[model samples]
Each structure stands twice: as C-alpha cells, then as structure tokens.
Target: MTFTTRFAPSPTGPLHLGHAYSALLAYDMARAANGVFHLRIDDIDQSRARPEWEAQIFDDLSWLGLSWPSPVLRQSDRVPRYRDALKTLWDQGLLYPCSCSRADIRAAASAPQEGAPLHGPDGLVYPGTCRPASPPSGPMPDAVMRLDMARALARLTHPLCFHETGAGPDGTTGEIHPLDMLQTVGDVVLARRDMGASYHLSVVIDDADQAITHVIRGRDLFDATQIHVLLQRLLNQPTPAYHHHRLIRDDTGKRLAKRDDARAIATYRAEGCTQADIRMKIGL
Candidate 1:
C-alpha cells in the first residue's frame, strides 16, 4: 500500500502551535516517502465550526509551506455516510442508543458502583445507562448512539495490533489485549445526537474511506486508538498504522490550545516569523 496519511483539524478556532506541528509533520513525512498527505476538515461538530476559521486553516498551512490534494474532505458533508455506518453497526447488535445526561453520568460515576468506576477514565467499564440488555429493535433511533464495548470486542476473532512508529504516552507500542480495552475505555459515543457522528466513529470511517495507510497524531489520542481499532474490526475497515507523537506545549508546559492566541501560527506570522521559525518553534 502507498504511504498515505492525513492531518484533520476542526475549524473551530485558530490553528495554534500544536496544529502547526501536526500538519507540518504529516506533510513532511508524506513528502519524505513520496506518499500522499490529505487535509480533512474535522468539522463534525458544526455548532462551533466557522468559515473564517476554516479559511485560516488553509492560509496558515499554506504559509507554513504545505499543500494538499484539492477538494478537501469536510465532515459536515458526510453525515449521511456516518449515519450509514451507524445503521450497519446498529443492525449488527453492536450499537445502542444513549440517553444518559451529563448530570446522570456525573452522579453515577461520583459514587462507585459494582466495584468499577463506570465513568472514570482509567476504570471506565461502562455506565450501561441506555445500553439495552439486548440490541434495541426498530429503525435506528434519532438519539446518541454508543458502541457496546464488550460486544464489539467479542466480534473480533483475531488479536488486535497496530504498527506504532511513534510511542504512546505510557510507551505502549502494540498488541492491545481485550482486557485492556474492557478495563479502560468503555462504551464510547459513536454518533452524537447533535453531531450525527462522534470523533471515534467519524475518524475511523474517514481514514478507511480515504484509504489512509498510516495515522499520525499526538500521543494524547493513544487511548482512543483502542476504540478505533475495535470499530475498524466491527466495520470490516482496515486499521491504519499509527504513530502517536509528542505534543507541543507552551512555556508553562501545558499543551497548546486555540485559546493561546500568542502561540497561534497567524500571530507568529504577523510577528514576522518564517515557516522555518514556526518549524523550529514546534521542534520539527
């Protein structure tokens, strides 16, 4: 397969130093191997996405010396596709509608039950609030849809693994066992009521549809990879080789956010910083 990867970002705010690092790095790697690099607009949450921010994403990346294939894939235009995948999972007894409110989850997670922290990140087994004992019967519901983690894992007959060119946060490399997933990441939201598809589901579908051979992103998303791998198996999609790189942080050692306007690529450009300066700032 060709060396294919992508840099997907939401147009919710300015592209910060972290975004620069990721996009530039992906672009560089793609060029190095004579591979393909794609720019995908991760506007799954349309509520916060803006045209100005999307425009700036193009401007900032171009200023940083990067170009991508035209007619970029935008999540807003792909809800129907996401819904199709959701329906497939729903029919396979792998998805169920979720109706638990934030308050309900917080209340349950705060008070430990069944010797498992249902809502706790590290101990997240599942809340099972809206998860039916058996897959609900009917056309797919118009509510939040969550994957049944255990059921999804059960469907995977083979041992799951991914090529880890970059290390995970805890230095985890490959060969993720089923227990690890069951112990940590629980029944995650695959399709949200408002967004139509959650990050995990949309990303899995997008990567597959794009024929992405490798997934390169920050280590913060390492844990989420487990969810993706499981979904890939359930959906019969190929799991791309993953490289979870280190994050770009501010002087305070906190991961850069869009709110950090001082670290925004546009701010640096306005201050007369060159593309190399941006690369150097992000330690490319």
Candidate 2:
C-alpha cells in the first residue's frame, strides 16, 4: 500500500524541539517512501488556538525544509464530519450522554464502592457515571458523549489489533491487543461538553477521511492507539500500521511541552541555529 502520514499539531503554543523531531520524522518517512505527507492543524480547542501560533507552525515547518499540499485540514472547520460520525455510533447504541465533569469523575472514582481509580492515556479513566442502560429518547443538549466500551466491543466479530513498528512506553512492540481498553479506557469521551468532539473521535475520523495508511507519531500516543484501534473497528474504518517513535526530552529528561518556549524552533532560529542543528539536538 502507498504510505501516508501526517504531522498534526495543536496551535495552542509554539513548536518546540519535540514538535520538530516528530514533524521532521514523519516528513522524512513519507518522502522516503515516495508517498503523501499531510499537515493537519488540530485546532479544535478554539478557546486557546491563536492565528499567530498557526502561522508560526507553517513558518517553522517551512524553515525545517518540509512541505505539504495546499488547503491543509483543520479540525475546527470539520465539525459536521465529526458530528456525523458521532451520530453513527449513537444510532448503533454505542454512545451515551455524560454529565460528569473532571472533578465529578475523580470523586466517583475515589468513592469507597468504586475502589482505586483506574488511569488511562487520558488520565483517570471515567467511572461510567452517565452511561445509560439504553439509548436516550432523543438528543442530549449541553452534555458530553462517551462510548460504551463494553457495548462497542461486543459488536466486534474478531479480536482488534494493530501493527506497531516502534516501541511503546514499556518497550512493547509488534501487534497490540486492546484488552485494557475496556478497563483502563473506560467509556472514553467521544465529544466534550464544550467541544463537539474529543481527540479520540476526531483523530479516528480524520485519519479515515485522509486515507492515512501509516501512523508515524511519538511514543506518547502508543497506549492511546488501543482506543483508536477500537474506534476504528466500531466505525468500520481501516486500521493503519503504527510507528511510535522515541520522544525528545530536555536535560532534565522530561518530555518537552509547547510551553517550553526556550526550546521552540523559532527561538532556536533566532539564536542562529540551523535545521541541521535541530536534527542533531533531537538526535535525528
């Protein structure tokens, strides 16, 4: 199959060295395979997204010697597609409205009856406070939507798995089984109360929409791939081969964040660092 990959970044902050490593790696892989490379702006969090940041992303990627086709996809402009996908799952009895806030979920998970709180890729796993016994009578306004993990898994005829060419957080590689998704990824939010769609939902839909064949990204998302694999099965979409590469970190060994402006590509450029300097810094 023709290889395809994307470097999707949220425009909430500057592109740090970590971002540079991921974008350059994906670009290099796609070019090496003579396949397509895409730039997707995951600007779904409209409250925090800034035009200047988005512009900086283009500038930084261009300065790093990367290119993608015009009319790059932005999550904000694709709400309708996400809603349609949610409706598909809702109609199939896989989704329900969730009214629990973060605090609410935490409290519920810590309750004596609930036992120790289970953590997942997205943090403390939801405690299923709003999961319904059956589909609601009609639409639920001002409520987040969550997938019924058990219900969704039951609809699958075959075991779900995805190929992994890169290491996971625990050095896991090869085919991955989504066994922990049910317990650890419990009823993950599909659509947020504020935003129409969550990362898990939007990403799955976006990959299928773009016909992405190879998902090359950081190891941080390796565990989340189980949730993605399950969503792909529920949505009847094709699963792509995954390569979760090592993350770039600071001297303290902590993974870089967008807030690390000192490590920002723009900062490095202003200090007279070239693209080669970036590659060497990130050990590419």
Candidate 3:
C-alpha cells in the first residue's frame, strides 16, 4: 500500500517549533517511503479559527520547504461529512445526545463513589450524564453527541489495536490495547452542541476520507489514538499505521503553545533565523 501521511494543524494560533517539527517529520517520513504527504487545516472551531493564522500556516510550511497538492482539506468545509458519520453511528445505536455542560460533567465525575475522575485525551472523562437507553427521535440542536463506549465496544467481535512505529508518551511501542482506552476514554463526544464535530470525530473521518495510511504526529496525541481507533472500527473505516514523534518543548520544558509568540516560526524568521536553524533547533 502507498504510504500516506498528513500534517493537520488547527488555525487557532501561529505555527510554533512544535508544529514545525511535526510537519517536517511527517514530510520526511513520506518522502523516505516514497509516499504522499497531505496538509489539512483543522479549523472546525469557527469561534477561534482566524483566516490570518491559516495563511501564516501556509507561509511557514512553505518556508520550511514543504509542498502539498492543490485544494487542501479544511475541517470547516467537511461538516456535512461529519454529520453523515454521526448519522451512521446513531443509526447503529452507538451515539446519544449529551445534554450536560462542562461544569455539569466535572461535578458529576467528581461526585462521591466515582473515585478520582478518569482523565482522557479530551480533558476530564465524561461522567455519562446524558447517554440514553436508545437514540433520540431526531438530532437536537442544543445537545452534544457522545459515543456510548460500552455499547460500541460490545458491537465489535474481535479485539481492536493499532500498529505504532513510534513510541507513546510513556515510551510504549507496538500494538496498543483497547482495554486502557475503555478505562480512560469514557464516552467521548463525536459532535459538540455548537460545533458539528469534535476533534476525535472529524480526525478519524478526515483520515479515512483522505485515505491516510500512516499517521505521523506528535506523541501528545498518542492517547487520543485509542479513541480514533475506536471510531474507525465503529465507522468500519480502515486504520492507519501510526508514528508518534517526541514533542518540542520550550526552555522551561513546557510544551509550546500558539500564544508563545516568541517561538513562532514567523518571529524566528524575522529575527534572521534560517530554515536550517529551525531544523537544527527541532533536532531534525
């Protein structure tokens, strides 16, 4: 099979060292394997996504010596696709409307007898406050849609796993188990009340739609891969091989954020930093 990878970044902020490292790594891997590398703009969060930031992403990646095909995939343009995926899950009795707010979820997860709340890739684990016995008559505008993990898992006859060429956050490699996923990632949201799709839902759908074969990205998303695999299985989509690279951290050892303007690629370029300098800084 042709090796296919992607560097998907949200336009909520400018490209930082971390973003550079990931994009370059994915590009290098694709080239090494004589594969295709794609660039996807994850601008689903319309409230935070800015056109200027999106343009900067193109400039930064091009400056780093990268090129992708025309008509790049953008999440904002794929809402209808996500809706179709949600409809499939709903029809299969795998999804339900979640009416609880963040505060409501936090309180429920923290309630007594729940022990310490299980934290997953999407922040505090959902307490399943809104999972229903059956699908609703129709989509509710005000309700976030969540996957019923237990029911979804039960639908699968065989065990779920993914091939990992790179290490996880804990330095784990090889096949990953879905057991930990069940314990940690509880009832993840597929579609938000405001936004049509959540990161987990859109990412899996996008990867499948793009026919992505190898998912090379930061190790920060290693845990989230569990959720992605589950979604892929539930949707009957093909799973791709994964390579989770180490993250680039700041001098203080914290993961770089978009707000860290000092570390932004544009800022570095303005300061007379060369493309080689970026590669060396990111240890390419």
Candidate 4:
C-alpha cells in the first residue's frame, strides 16, 4: 500500500509551535515517501469548536507552506459514522454505558483499599464503577460508552501488534500486553454524553476510515498507541506504522499546550518571524 498519514488537531484553540512541528513533520515525511498527507479537523467537541478557529487552522497551515486535499474531514460532520462503530462494538458485547461522574470515580479510586487511583491515557483509569457485571443487552443506550477492555481482548483471534518507527518507553515493533493494558488502559471512553465520541474512539475510527498508513504524533502519546491498536483489532481495521517524535516544549520544559498563546504560530507570524525561523525554533 502507498504510504499515507494524517495530522489531526482539535480546533479548540490556536495552533502552537508543537502543532507546526507535528504537521510539518508529517507533511515532510509524506512528501519524501511520495505519500498522501491529510489534514483532519478534530472538532468533535462541538461546544468548543468554532468556525473562526477552523478557518484559522487552514490559514495557519497555508502560511507554513503546507497543503492538503480539499473538503477537509471534520469530526463534527461524522457523528453517525462514530455511532455505527460504537453500535457494532455494543452488539458484540464489547462496549457498555458508563454513568460514573468524575467525583464518583475519584472517590472510588481513592479508597484506602484501592490504593492511589491508577492513571491511564483516558485519565484516572476508570474504576469500572458503572460497568455492568456482564455484557450489556438491548439497544445501545445513547449515553457515555466505554470499551469492555477485557472482553474486547477475548474477541481477538490473533495476537495484536503494530510496526513502530517511533521511540516509545519500550522498543520498536509495538506489541499489546493484554494484562498490562487491562490494568492500565481499563475501559477507555468510546462515546461521550455530549460529544457523542471520545478522542480515543474518534481518532481510531478516523484513521482507519481515511486509510492512514502512518500515524505521526508526539512521544507523549506513545502509551496511548496500544489502546488504538486494540481498537483496530476489534474493529477489523489496519494498524498503521507510527512515528512518535519528540515534543516541542517551552523554556521551562513543559510541553506546549493550546493555552500557551505565547508560542502560538499566529503570534510568531505577528512578531515578523518567517517560516524558516519557525523550523529553527522547533529544531526541525
């Protein structure tokens, strides 16, 4: 298959230096490999997605001399598609509804007997508070949904693995360790009460649907790759090779966030910095 990849960003805020590095790196690699590079707007959280920011994404990428195919794939336009995937998992007894509030989870997870709440990609690994004792039945409720990781694992007919061109906490050639994931990644959210899908769920489906052959992101997300791999196996989609590059951090060594407006690409542009300057600033 031809090399293909994507840079998906939430339009919840301005694109910063880190965003530029990820996008430019993916676009550069795709160009070098004679592959297709896609730009996907991860605007699933409609409450925060704004038209101005969506337009700014286009403008910023263009200003950085990057381009992608027209009619960009916006997650906001694909709720039905996400729901269909959720429904399939639900029918297979691999997913269930979750009604645990943040406070409920914190209380249960912090109980003296449970030890400190274990943290995971989805944050504070779900205590399975709302998880039914058995696979849920009947129509999948239109509420928050989570993967039954243990059950999801049992459905896999073969060992799950993916090629890794990136450096993770482990070595290359990623492999899924079921027990490790069970304890750590535990029942990640698949659907949200308001957004209809969580980032993990939306990303897996989007990458597969777009036929992405390579997933390029920061090393920070290396731990989350297993979650995606498991989802790929469950959904019967191809797991792409991954390239997790180093993150762009501020002088203080903290990774750049959307709130870091000082490092915003737009701010740099206003300061009269050139694209070449950006490459140097990000150590590209």
Candidate 5:
C-alpha cells in the first residue's frame, strides 16, 4: 500500500522545536517514500486552542519547507465523526460510563493490587468502582466513557503487533508486538462524558479518515500506541505502522512545550536561525 503519514499538533500554543522535529521527520519520510504527508490540527480542546496558534502552525510548517498533500484536518470540526465512533463502541458493549471524580480514582488506587501496582493509564485501574453502578440499559451516562480495557485484552485471539518503520535500537525500522494492554497501561479514557471525545478516539478516527498508513511522531507516545492498537482491533480498523522518533529537549533535559516560547520556531527564526540551523538544533 502507498505509505501515508501525518503530523498532528495541538494548537494550544506556538510551535516549538520539538514540534518542528516531529513535523519535519514525518515530512521527510513521506517525501523519501514518495508517500503523502498530511497536516492535522488536534484542536479538540476548544477551550485552549486558539485560531492564532492554528494560523501560526501553517506559517511555521511552510517556513520549514514542508508541504502536505491536502488541506489540514482539524479535530474541532470532526466532533460528529468522533461521536459516531463512540456510539459504535457503546453499541458493542465495549464501553461504560465512568462517574468517579479525579479524587475518587486516586483514593481507590491508594490500595495496590497484588504485584499489579494498582494503577495504569486512566489512574488506579478504575477498581471497577463504577462498574457495579453502570446502568443496565439505554445510552451511557454523561460522565466520561472508558473502554473495558481488561475486556479488550481478553478478546485478542493472538498477541497483537505493529511494525515501526525507521526506528529501533539501531535507528532502523522494526516490527514490535505482543502488546499486553492491561499489565502495562491500564484502562484509558475513550471519550470523556464531558470532553466530547478523548485523545485516543479522536486520533484513531482522524488517522483512518485521512488514510494515514504510517504514524510518525515522538517516543513519548510509544506506550500509548498499545491503546490505539487495541482500539483499532475492537473497531476492526486497519492498524498503521508507527515510527516514534526521539524528542528534542532543552538544556535542562525537559521535553519542549509551547510554554517554552523561548524555543518556539518563530522565535528561533526571529533570532536569525536559518533552516539549516533549525535542522542542526533539532538533529533532524
């Protein structure tokens, strides 16, 4: 199949060095393979996503000489699509409403499970606190909806796996597998009852809709890939190959963020940093 990849950045702040590295890396791979590179704005968090930041993203990517094949896909405009996916998962009995507050989950997780560490992605492995309270019929509650991760794991007939192209111990693409969802990363939120949709659901739906074949981003998200893989299986959607590149960090060794405007792409450019300088600074 023709390779297709994307660089999806949240427009909560200006594009920083780390953002540039990820976008450039994905663009390079797409170009090298004669594939398609798509740009997507993960602006689902409407509360923080600003139009100015979104506009700046387009300017910065163009400045770096990167180009995508089509118009960018903004998550904010794709709520209906995400909602549809949630409805499907709920219909299949793969999801349940979680009303436990943030503190409640922490309290339940205070007691550890034997050799299980008592915690996972969604905080405290849920303890099934709300499981007993789940409604018997009709639509799920307005509270956050979480997929039955433990249930998802048991349904896998064989150990699930995905190939990661252009990334491995030796900087080469390799296939990794047998992702044990429950043991490592616990139940992740699929769609927060109040947030409209969770990162996991929005991302998978957008990628599939954009026909992204390879997902190239940061290593920080490598673990999260397991959750995405499981969701793909549950939804019977095609799984894309992944390439999680190393992250660009500041002298303090912390991963860059939008708040680090001192290292923002536009800032660097204003300071007379050339395209090659950026390439060197980010090790692209």
Candidate 6:
C-alpha cells in the first residue's frame, strides 16, 4: 500500500510551535517517501471551536509551506460517521454510561492507588467510580460514556505494538509495544453522552476513512495510543504504524500548550518570523 499520514489539529486554539513541529515532521516524511500527507481539523468539540481559529490553522500551515491533499477533512461535518461507530460499540456491550461527577470521582480515587485515573488533553485523570456500579438497563448518562476496559482487553490475542519510522536522538529506529491497555490507560471515554463523539472514536473513523497508513504525532500521546489500539480492535479497524516524535518544549523544558499563545503560529507570523525560523526552531 502507498504510505499515507495525517496531521489533525483542533480549531479551538491557534497553532503553536508544537503544532508546527508535528505538521512539519509528518509533511517531511510524506515528501521524502513520495507519499500522501493529509490534514484534518479536529473540530468535534463544538463548544470551544471557532471559525477564526480554523482559518488561522489554514493560514499558519500555508505560511509554513505545508499543503494537504484535496479539501481538508473537518470532524464537525462528520458527526454521523462517529455516531455510527459509537452505536456499534454500544451494541457490542463495550461502552457504558458514566454518571460520576468530578467531585464524586475525586472521592473515589482518594481511596488510593487502585483504578487508573482517566484524563484528556486538559489533564485531571478521571476516577472510574461508576464503572463497577454502572447500570445495565437505563438510558446512557447525560455526562459521559466510557469504554469497558476489562471487557475490551479480554478479546486481545498477542500484546499490541507500533513502530516509529523517523530518525531518533540516538540515531535508532523506535518501536513501542507489549502494551497492557487495562493497567496503564484504563477505561477512557468514547463520548460525553452530551457531546457528539470522543477523540479516540472520531480519530479511528477519520483515519480509516482517509486511508491513513501511518500515524505521526508527539510522544506525549504515546500512552493514549493504547486506548486507540484497543478501540481499533473493538471496532475491527486497521491499526496503522505509529511514529510518536519528540515534543517541542519551552526554555523551562515543559511541553508547549495551546494556551501558550506567545508561541502560537499566528503570533510568530505577526512578529515576521519566517517559515525557515519555525523549521529551525523545531529542528525539522
């Protein structure tokens, strides 16, 4: 099969150095291999996503001399596809409604190191308080729907693994594997019974639809790959080769964030920073 890769970014915030690094790395890999590089806007979080941010994403990528094939895929326009997969998981008995509040989860997790804490890009790990007590016959909760991790794990055969294709710090190729989905990542959300879809669900569907054969992204999401792998298995989707690259950090050595607007690609452009400057800063 021809090599295919993608860079997916949410439109809730401006692209930053981190976004530039990921986009450039994927772009270079595709260019070097004479492969296809695609772009997708992860605009499923309708609450925070805005038109201006989406426009900025396109502007920023263009400024950096990157281009995706055809019209870009937008998640907001693909809710039906995500919903279909979600219903499939729910029908398979792999998903359950969650009713626990933040306070409730805190109280449950306070019992000490037992269940893995659930988290998202924002950072507070969710405690699976209702996972055990979840109702079988009621309507799904209004808050969230979580995957049944134990049930999902029971179906796996060999341990899961993914290979990193790009060159590394030690000049070695990297492969990650022997992943245990239950212990490390735990039961993650598939949707807010309130929201349209979760990141894991939407991403797998989109990647498959886009025919993405390789996933090139930051190392920070390496742990989350287990969750995506599990979803791929449950949904009977192909698991692509994954390249988790190094993250871009600040002077303090902390990973850059969307909230760090000072590093936003728009800011850099405003200050007349050249595409070459971004390329050099990210070591592309």
Best by lDDT: 4
Candidate 5 lDDT, tens digit per residue, 1-284?
A: 88899989998899999998999888888889989999989988988899999899999999999887666788888888888888887777768877888788777766565334455444456666665344235875566887776666667786677888655435644333434455556666888755589998998998888888999988777767777877887878889989888888889889888899999999999999888999998887
What are the Cα lDDT values of the candidates? 0.87, 0.89, 0.89, 0.90, 0.79, 0.78
Residue pair clashes in candidate 6: 118-126
Clashes of 6: 1
- Error in Å for residue 47 of model 6: 0.7
Task: Name the better of 1 and 6 by TM-score.
Answer: 1
> What tens digits encode model 6's per-residue C-alpha lDDT throughout 1-284?
88899999998888999999999989999899899999899988888999999898898998899988778899989988887887777777777777877777766766566454555432445555667654355444444788887776766786655566654444444343433445445667788654588888888899889988999998777666667776787788888888878889999999999999999988988999999998898887
Which of the two candidates, 4 or 5, achieves a greater TM-score against the reference? 4
Whole-model lDDT for model 2 versus the true structure?
0.89
Which model scores highest in TM-score? 4
Cα error, candidate 1, residue 95 (Å): 1.1
**Cα error, candidate 4, residue 141 (Å):** 0.8
Candidate RMSDs in Å, in order, are 1.7, 1.3, 1.4, 1.1, 2.8, 3.3
lDDT of 1 by residue, 44-68 (tens): 8989999999999999998888888
lDDT of 3 by residue, 171-266 (tens): 987555656666788888889866899999999999999999999988999988988988898889999999999999988899999999999999
Off by over 4 Å in 4: 169-173
User: What value of lDDT does candidate 4 attain over all alpha carbons?
Assistant: 0.90
* Candidate 2 clash pair list: none
Q: 250, model 5: CA deviation in Å?
A: 1.1
lDDT of 4 at 152: 90
Q: After superposition, how far is residue 69 of candidate 3 from its true place, in Å?
A: 0.5
Flag regions of model 6 displaced more than 4 Å. 112-127, 132-143, 166-180
True lDDT of residue 163, candidate 1: 83
Global Cα lDDT for candidate 3: 0.89
